[model samples]
Target: MERLKLDYNILVIDDDKELCALIKQSVTKENISAEHCYSGADGLILLEKNDYHLIVLDVMMPGMDGFQTMKKIRKQSSIPILMLTSKNDSMSKVHGLRSGADDYLTKPFDMEELIARIISLIRRYTRFNFVDNHSQPLTYKGLTIDFDSRSVITQNGTFELPRKEFDLLLFCAKNQGRILTKQQIYEEVWGESYVYDDSNIMAIISRLRKKIEPDSGTPFYIQTVKGIGYRFNKEV
Candidate 1:
């Protein structure tokens, strides 16, 4: 039984040879192919040479860190990117998101969780491109969504969004002012028919808030409904 979807190639740019081998082995089980690069410059060169479905990059690298490489990549491609960082590093996570990473996973993460994130990111990216091909108007928070580009911009600045956050944001924006239950959101944004552990959705929402909200603690874009789900309070 071929388990992996085998739809796209994944490029992993990291200095850790063992981790890269682990990821390549794990991802290959899903029928997906992976390429590895130990240097930032090498990853850039590979990016120029091939088309990758997703990029899993490590934050702490020798010559050029993941952030710098991603920054450079953003100047060319909007491909989905997942960043790997040290555990509980809030500042690095923030900086990674701000630098156009699609998702960030801490080091020593569960392999299952990493695979789930990759799938979710790819699904969201595909959906956004679908909407873009149809020329849909995706607007929220006085910002316009560009499905083709996978980016959001305001008068203050423009930022690239990682896969799931972009889908979550567009989902909420498309349903502005309507409170959506967690299950509904999980099904839609995650593209999963089965129920997921709601904690993942909450984390995704939190990530989205931190990226778009002026203040994540006092968020105006995505608001919780206590026992319910969440609502995109565009009016707020």
Candidate 2:
């Protein structure tokens, strides 16, 4: 496949020097600049000095594991993160996502898939960050979403959600009163096909509800439409 020419920079954090070098080489072929660090500490230092459009983080390391590194990074930056893990278990993937990773790839992944995911992440990130100067914030009830700032305000408090969650909420808000299928939500928000089961979407929706819903158990903003999908309550 011909790779799209992207001017984005990506950071790769892993303990394996060979693997990092390989990943850097693969992404560079697509005109996407990449820098890598063998340890989480070095990655953190590099992140402090440079701006990165996305990150490919490995879950296991000597110290300050990817989860720890990612948690610290999340405190300061909302850059898209795609976690790489040797473990193929669902729990590990879930942990990565909950720890602020935007996506995850199992070990021995195809180079094409990695490049595709990298491109998709950067594209979505660029789209979400691009806002019109004259655009108005979306306001419903006590919830307010500032598109330019990517901030969310609710009766509970103000929140700056992680990129995926914020994008999901923004998509739902834009199409309020419409029931969105899992496939639609996945392809749109994830910028990928809907091959996996609905677990990913459900996880994100659960997290979003906890943030914006008055009661997460009985969500007021996002309502599930039985077996079809979910609908953002227009009456909220």
Candidate 3:
């Protein structure tokens, strides 16, 4: 049996207005609406004014760049996002995923392939994107974190956190119920062994607690072990 097709509104956020025009022209087909924004700021503004089923984002831009922009969008909507990048490096892909992009395609890609990915991502998330995906992360209470897309929803509201903070929080969440020493956390998130008297770990933890905890002083998710380190309360 043939599946019923649905119309999709796709917003492409890239600095190259010319490329945007080319994409709009190339991807023109029935049931697909493609709109372009010149910058991340413009994209955010347009999002407030309109609705979209998905987003095609470019990695490098004048101001916000793809990572930063993706974070902001994830804060509000779980709409599938496909990131475009000129750099084909593994690090770039990792960073994009860690920053909240659903999927990524290197630049100079075939328009046809791009279109297909869009359809696939939309269909999967729109219908079959379930909570049991195990890959998904959530706060026992109110927080929700989508690791694949690198987004967070807290009591305050949805926020796209900076890269370091995201890593810190993800590490904490993954290690819930286990006490992670400052040295352990520093190495895990920042990729370096801990040094004495350094406040880098404390700083990141403090900032993260403020964002996810209902009350930083009396944190519910991340608990202070006092003189040892911190741990995400598994009991929460």
Candidate 4:
């Protein structure tokens, strides 16, 4: 018998009650169930008590804020987190993504865009388990991706990566030796090419390299093809 597929449960942690309600209404369609927590502190409590597939977090909460909340969450789970902030500055995005957020969106964002990002993360985390004809895991050098278990074995360690990061690295690994432009990467990984934001891709790549490469600065697995795109080092 096949397991019945259920909608993904999402947690939204923000101080904006009205916006939370709006997001809950907007994303609570077909295969998504949205829940709200008015503050990061409250959200953490809910996190401990329940399971959620994705978290939509606000960066400017009253007390703990998104970064602090994310830090605590990372200590416990690798659930996909999409950070929302009013700040468009690069540093905020860097800090959020580096600390554990799977993606970031600025405030006053298009609801459609938010829904797209939320769905992308949920699908990657919950629905993906692709294998070739022989059901062999993908590997290069010491890195092995077990799609069945959603785990990766790297030179550093065998780790269960957050869904978005895993999918990003998997794509690069599979298409080794080919130049993948930002457009292609976004379209393939995000399922959209409209929002050409380099910060998000760069953040995920940075996080991936840290896990797999000996040194992120001198990456041996994925190389940036200056001015054009990235190439997964085929020689590896």
lDDT leader: 2
Q: Where does candidate 1 stray beyond 4 Å?
A: 1-6, 136-236
Model 2 over residues 114-168: C-alpha lDDT tens digits? 9988887786566546533356677778788887778788877888888889889
Q: Global lDDT for candidate 4?
A: 0.80
Candidate 4 per-residue lDDT, tens place, 1-236, comes to: 12225777999999999999999998766457889998889999999888998999999999899999999998888688899999999878767765767778998899888988787667556533344444567776887888777788887988888888877887766555455677767777888753868999999999888888888899898899776568778566
Error of model 1, residue 26, in angstroms: 0.8
- Collision pairs in model 2: none
Candidates by lDDT, descending order:
2, 4, 1, 3
TM-score of each: 0.59, 0.61, 0.54, 0.59
Mark the regions of model 4 whose C-alpha exceeds 4 Å error after superposition. 1-5, 128-236
* Candidate models: Cα lDDT each: 0.78, 0.82, 0.76, 0.80
Instruction: Report the C-alpha lDDT of model 1 over 86-143, residue by residue, as the tens digit.
Output: 8586667656765667678998899999988777666556655766689675665556
Report the C-alpha displacement of residue 21, candidate 1, in angstroms. 1.1
**Of 1 and 4, which scores higher on lDDT?**
4
